[model samples]
Target: MASPKSAAIAALRRQLMMGDGLSPSPAPQVTRLGIAAIDAVLPWGGLPGGAIHEVTGPENDGAATGFCTTLLARLSAGTRPVLWVTAHDDLYAPGLAAFGLSPERLIVVRARRAAETFWTIEEALRCRSLAAVLGEVRGPSRTVARRLQLVARSSGVTAVLLRHDEDDAFANAITRWHVVSARRDDAAEDDSDARWRVDLVRCRGRIHGEEGYVARWFVEWRAATGDFGVVADLRDRPDRPAPARMAR
Candidate 1:
């Protein structure tokens, strides 16, 4: 039998999912990444919608952009537009079509300085009509990160911060991921399908002691299927024995 207090809490959670009683309907409780390997490890069974997530990659590596854009496609899979704020205008719009993000639904904001970038991101996050807001900055202070996290939580907007290769400042985001490009196992020359080696360097609510306990995966985005999935398990690859390093 369910205890009274437990049942009430469950009821409240259900109501929140339905966007009634306490939370607004515009924001869903969670946005499943749709990748089983990654989603299963997340505390919420998916990326927390109304929170901030940070992604970084090696300097000049194109993998980070690919991974983030694919993620944004999943995060903003609705009628609401996605806001992308950055100081640079190097993002190629046509490349995004392959990732399922239409250029029409993406609103780009060019900021002249880092402060302007963060300010614009903060303001965009507060808008309920936006499905997600992505900010590209070189570095941000911990204080600014905290402010962004708090605002995302309050407004129920998914926030993504993309850091350049050299910028590795600490942040208060729920999850911090490091991405790098990986070659396909088949050794194909074409770039039709892309692979990535992703590392979860920090997760806010990760279990203690197990902070070091981790596993890495080779994630792939299949253009044919339009989804992301684990292409190879780094720990145990089909072509090789148990290895400490990924088959990059």
Candidate 2:
């Protein structure tokens, strides 16, 4: 009962999905952050899947790792395992559990050199069964980054790069984030919450006039519920009160 034009369109869509035609494969869907305000500004309404994202922090600061772990927890909510590649063996499994990432759901790969680390990351990204891949590299060249981005897109897997210090811009990355620990004046001795100043330094496909799309938020990760709560959005006026906590 389908019309000729309609049926033709449907067949073309099928081919596209199956990667049978000349057109490139469809871009992976977006993954929402579960925060309305944050999602609203992004081009895809959230983090784009099948792309590379970068997170960086100051030396000896665990803020970047913590933030990346939070993202891994969200992405690996399903049964698929996540691959984490690093050159060092300093990762604490128990600490990761605080961020909702369990040892059983993670596979750690220790590479002896930076080249090996990137190789492992690319291989992991090619595996369709993995929920995501995280690589701890100081600074990857633009060529290496582009290669990873293409592989991730083709395999439909998310790739995250964790760095201890600032590096040159990665042109192929979908987003770049900077995180730093934030101090709370009023705090309890037993508080296990993690507070950070998260900055969205660069996001592709963002439209905010000529001012460039940069945003900052003071956020806290609740250890009990494994949720992220926004303390404040610095983009707003200082006098304005912070918004209510975002529901997961």
Candidate 3:
């Protein structure tokens, strides 16, 4: 049973998908984050498929990459391969494997220029063969964002933009996320686990009070299971103390 707020957001998303004189497509399947509280807030009960989402972090922050890799691992659970486009050749296959995304399931494309990167992402989104497309881009224009969104919708492929730029110029993305490294006091003891403070900065079709639609969570990624566990929900109480370990 969908909550009233969830239903409303779904309706709004449908309306937006139907705009620009394009015929309505069937509702897309969602990928749950495996965290109940996080899932509950999402309009589709999870991250919506056939839509474009953005993730960002401070310069040189690997937490954002870790977060996106986890998402890709989930999205590419099936036989369909995922396409990753980036200008820099910095993606480590071993590190990605630790996050549960195998190199065999990935197709990497090296585009030296921004234009080439965007073009590759758009083309990959149009291919129904891909389960998802991730592009490491910075400061994409509004026009490029819309074009990618439309293509992803038509092809039913999820698109994720991993950005390091602070520009918030893209209004067409369905969601925007900001991720940063979270420090734990016993960090040396649990060096294998990656902790992050994830902020849902923008969500289309979701309404909130003066605080806007922002939500924050402290999450820990367990290397053994390659899964995320909630450390704490900081939305309503930012100062709330996190548990010594993530909730199982």
- Please, what are the lDDT tens digits per residue for candidate 3 over residues 43-78? 667888888888988867899998898889888984
Query: Which lDDT tens digits does candidate 2 get at residues 1-248?
Result: 89999899766654543341111447466777766666776655777678888888886889999988878877887467999997788899999988878878999999989899999999999998998999998788878887898788788899989988575767677688888988754536535377888777776543222323256677777778877777664444234332322111
Candidates sorted by lDDT, best first: 3, 2, 1
Per-residue alpha-carbon lDDT of model 1 for 64-150, expressed as tens digits? 888788778888885568999977788888888778888788999999998999999999989988989999877788788778877
Candidate 2, residue 248: the lDDT equals 17
TM-score of each: 0.78, 0.80, 0.84
Evaluated against the true structure, the overall lDDT of model 1 is: 0.73
Q: Report every candidate's CA lDDT.
A: 0.73, 0.75, 0.78
* Candidate of highest lDDT: 3
Q: How many pairs of residues in model 2 come into backbone collision?
A: 0
Off by over 4 Å in 3: 1-13, 16-23, 187-192, 208-213, 233-248
TM-score computed on alpha carbons, candidate 2: 0.80
Q: Count backbone clashes in candidate 3.
A: 0
Q: What lDDT does candidate 2 reach at residue 188?
A: 62
Where model 1 places Cα greater than 4 Å from the true spot, the runs are: 1-28, 166-169, 186-192, 208-213, 233-248
Poorest stretch of ten by lDDT in candidate 3: 239-248
